[model samples]
Target: MWLYAGRRIVLTIPILLGVTIICFALVQIAPGDPIQNLLSPTATAQDAARLRAAYGLDQPLMVQYFIWLGKVCVGNLGMSISDNVPVAGEVLHAFVNTIVIALISVVLAFVVSMIFGVIAAYRTGSLADRLITAVAVFGISVPPFWLGVILVIFFAVDLSWLPATGMGASGSETFSYFRWADFKFAIMPIIALALPPLGIMTRTTRSSIAEILNQDFIQTLRAKGLSEAQVIVHAVVNIMPQAVAMLGLQLGYLIGGSVLVETVFTWPGTGYLLNKAVLTRDIPLLQGTILVLATAFVLINLVVDLAQSLIDPRLKRS
Candidate 1:
């Protein structure tokens, strides 16, 4: 197991490097100058040129990239031209905010999906199963941004049950962790972001459980006079490898999806930070944020792979 883990960690280095290189190259290819955006309309051409030179934007693209890469290696992510803040500090703050929202959504999705999936599988062909499947289909089909807007309209505007947007009320020094106020504010955004994954997981679980139910061992269990509940628990345990694998992948997707979800909801998160960087062409902030997110994605996938091997001895042998 240690050997396998070490192998996975070693493999992640190239993946992260590839991501950094590709994102750096693509950002360079994007039109419009970050310096142009930073300069004031009243500034003369010479003034803009001087500013660009100071920021090293006047340098060759490759030179700028290597310079930035070297700085990143030495633990400096540069400063955000748009925000006038250290890139690392801004991204770290956003990272915390994004992870908090993503974690809640993942837990909510996992519990809801597992429960409904198990119930649907256990009650196959029943009205409850059909209804749950239908709901899952609808959830999967709905767009998160649209869903978020609709939720804001109904829950925040029409009903006035929650604040329309923003992380918290203005002029606040601290945050409310478990207040009704905060829950009302955050619940819709979390649900909107989680719905698709929840639906996907539900479907995956139901299919996995159904397959397990048809296995010869399940029949043997039934023939041995085991109750349906006993058979289901055994079948679920047997089918857990796939479920665990899916959970890991879905968790990654949920984290990635926060970018769009945060934007729609006006939530303060890494996704929103990235969006801000792109809009203003803040290269250092964008590059650093992408690196952090990509690193996280690679690590999560590695952990998931290890989990699958642990759950199934066949995987370990392979």
Candidate 2:
């Protein structure tokens, strides 16, 4: 098990390097100069050239990449051109915000989806199953941003039960833990981030469970006089490898979706930070943030792989 985990971690090195190349390339191709962001409207051609030179933007792309890569290797995430502060701190802050929202959202989505999926599977063609499946389909189809807007209008503005946007209190900048006011603010955004993935998981679970129920072992267990509930509980446990694997996939989706959800909700997560970075063209900040998110994605999959192996020891042998 340790060896398998070690192998996965070692493999992430190349993937991380490739991610850096792709992220850097895409950002470079994007229009709008970070230099333009640096200069005032009245700045002259000389000033533009000087600023470019100062920032080494005049250097070949490859050179600039290597320079940034070198700094990244030494624990420096580089400085924000706009604020001239260490990008590491800002990136870390945003990373924390994202983890808080993403973690809760992922777990809640996974558990709820499993329960709903099981209920739907049991009911099969009944009205209850139809309603559950329809809800899941609607969740899968609805764009999270639109859902977020609707939720904000209905729950925050009209009902006044929750705050519309932002992650903190009247004066506090970010949420550290569960505080009633900020937690209330987070509820809507979390629901927004969870729904799409939850919907996908529900559909997948219902299908997987249906398949498991038809298996020979399930029939054998039924023949042994086990109740349907007992057999289903066993089947659910047996089917967990696939469910856990899906968790990794859904987690990736949820993290990516949080970008839009955060924006709509004005949540102070990495997605919101990322939006600001693009507007200001904070290259180093963008680079660092993308790298961190990529690292998280890889790590989440690794953990899921290990979990599968643990759940089904045959996976470890393979």
Candidate 3:
């Protein structure tokens, strides 16, 4: 397991580097010059030239990339052209916010999926099963932004059950675990972000449980007079490794999707921060945000791989 984990960890470096290269190239080669945008509208050609030199934009592309890469390695993400804030500070702060939102969303998704999945599998072709299936399908099909708007209109606008914008009450910067207002503010966005993954997980769990039930061992257990609950639990335990692996990957997707959901809901999360940075061409913040996200995804995949090996010994064998 250690060897496998080490291999996975080693592989993450190149994958992250590749992502950086592609993102950097796209940002650099894209049609707008950050320096040009920063200058006065009536500025002379020499003004543009000085701004270019100031930001080292006049250097060769490769040289510029190396300079940026060096800065990144040493923990300097560069300054935001728009705000002049340290890139690391802004990105790290946004990342911490994103993590809080992502964790809540994952917990909600897992709990909801497990309950519905077990019900659908146990009830099989009953009306309850059909309803669960339909709900899952709808959850999976709906775009998060659209869902966010509908939720805001119904829950926030009409009912006034929750706040429609921001992470918390207007001036509350630091979060509090015991605050009802903060929790209520987080719910709508978490629900919208979690829906698709919850749906997918429910379907996967239902199918996996059903398949396990058909196995000879399950039939033998039934013949031996095992209770249905006991049998189901045993089957779920056996297939849980695969389900866990699926959850890991899905969690990564959920985190990424939260960006869009947060944007639509006007929630203050890493996703929303990244979107704002991109619009304003905050290169340092953009690079930091994307790198952090990619790193998280890679780490999630690695953890899942290790978990699979632990759950199923055969996975670690030839």
- Write down the RMSD of all candidates, one decimal each: 2.2, 1.8, 1.9
Highest TM-score: give the candidate number: 2
TM-score of 2: 0.93
Query: Which regions of candidate 1 fall more than 4 Å away from where they truly are?
Result: 42-45, 60-62, 170-173
lDDT of 2 at 39: 85
| Superposition-based RMSD of candidate 2 using all C-alpha atoms, in angstroms | 1.8
> What's the true lDDT of residue 58 in model 1?
90
Candidate 3 residue 33 C-alpha distance from true site, Å: 1.7
Ranking by lDDT: 2, 1, 3
In candidate 2, stretches whose alpha carbon ends up further than 4 angstroms from where it belongs are 170-174
The whole-model lDDT of each prediction reads 0.81, 0.84, 0.81
Model 2 steric clash pairs: none
lDDT of 1: 0.81
Give per-residue CA lDDT, model 1, range 186-261, as digits (tens). 7887888889888898998888888888889999999999998899889778777887777778777776667777
